[model samples]
Target: MSLNIYHEARSEPQIGQLAVAHVTLNRASQSKQTVEQVVTAPKQFSWTFLQKSYVPKETDIFVDCIQTAMKAMTSKDFTKGATFYHRHDVRPKWAQSKTYVAKYGEHLFYRN
Candidate 1:
């Protein structure tokens, strides 16, 4: 979860990181899967497959992600139950049918 938050939203603001984490949690809850299952499921998080290495290169940022993940576990989701998200710079075909939620940092959030 920390890795997902770090890779996906490390460059984004703190709220963005928390939003991504909440999406992961929401997916896990909705799918009746563990967070690990949701995170490791194929094609769920781009960084899990797109990156050659899972090792985090930025220690400080990684630590911040860990803290964010912890906070997300108990924080009231500000994403309005968003289950999907994509970066603002790209348009994914799947997003066309999703319910648009709020944007936090660089990511556009959605729910089905």
Candidate 2:
């Protein structure tokens, strides 16, 4: 989940990392899924905690950004209720039925 956020929205301005964080948190709230489940749900994100090849890198900047975003969300939720997002360069079939929320950087966010 955090990897997807770091890769997908980390490059976008407007504190896009917060939007990424919000997606996970919002999904957890609406679906009663733990943060892990929401992130690992089939086809939700490209990278997950289970991949054998995955390595946990501690990038100080990435951690800092995500930490800031998480802190910002404690008082008020952002993301415009976005529970889903996809790269702006591609349009997946799942998006056809979801409500468009907003685009952070390279990601276009959506929700039911």
Candidate 3:
């Protein structure tokens, strides 16, 4: 989960990292899968599909992501149950049907 948050939203602010973390948690709960399953599922998180090492190189940022992942587990979800998100620069076809929830840092959040 920390790796997902780091690779996906490391450039984002703390709030955005939290949002991504919550999306992971929300997906896990909704899909009846564990966090690892939700994170490693095919085509779910881009980092998983990208042909590269999963090791986090930025130690400081990775630590921050780990903290964000922990905080998200106990904090109230400000995303209002967003199950999907994408970087602000791209528009995925799937996003057209999902309700726009909010934007935090470089990511936009959505929910079905």
Tens-place lDDT digits, model 2, residues 50-80: 4533333658656765665567567466677
Error of 2 at 33 (Å): 1.7
List the candidate 1 regions with Cα displacement exceeding 4 Å: none
Judged by whole-model lDDT over C-alpha atoms, candidate 3 comes out at 0.92
lDDT of 3 by residue, 13-67 (tens): 8988999999999999899999999999999999899864689899998998888
Scanning candidate 1 in windows of ten residues, the lowest lDDT window is 47-56
What lDDT does the true structure give each of the candidates? Answer: 0.93, 0.72, 0.92
The candidates, ranked best first by lDDT, are 1, 3, 2
**Residue 47's lDDT in candidate 1:** 85
Question: CA RMSD for every model?
Answer: 0.8, 2.7, 0.8
lDDT of 2 at 52: 30
Runs of candidate 3 with Cα error greater than 4 angstroms are none
Residue pairs in clash, model 3: none
Q: Over the full model, what C-alpha lDDT does candidate 2 score relative to the true structure? A: 0.72
TM-score of each: 0.97, 0.77, 0.97
